[model samples]
Target: MHPETHLALHHTRATDLRAEAAAHRLAAQARRPYAIRTRLGWTLVEVGLRLASPRPAFAH
Candidate 1:
């Protein structure tokens, strides 16, 4: 491989690694209070809506 191409690939991989790390850290920090709560709230709303409305029958 050409030196420049190799260097470019290396830089791209490094950037991707950093981005993945940042995403993981943010997810971990938010998992407890942010993501979990938001997901649970949505789930509750969905269940409530399902309970309030009957599902439509599908034609075979």
Candidate 2:
């Protein structure tokens, strides 16, 4: 293949790959709120469990 043609092909492939990666990144960003909510729910559950548990008394 000619050098110019190879370079063009490489540029097209790189652009396509970049577009694909950008789409994936946007998808992840869209789901970020759900991920944060899930983490917050778990953290709240942990806090609730800690509050419900009994503590040991120290000897005087």
Best by TM-score: 2
Number of the top-ranking candidate, with lDDT as the measure: 2
Cα RMSD for candidates in order: 7.0, 1.8
lDDT of 2 by residue, 13-59 (tens): 99999999999999999889899899999999999999999998999
Regions more than 4 Å wrong, model 1: 32-60
- Runs of candidate 2 exceeding 4 Å displacement: 52-54
**Candidate 2 residue pairs in backbone clash:** none
TM-score of each: 0.51, 0.73
Local accuracy by lDDT, each model: 0.94, 0.97
What C-alpha lDDT, on a 0 to 100 scale, does residue 29 get in candidate 1?
Answer: 85
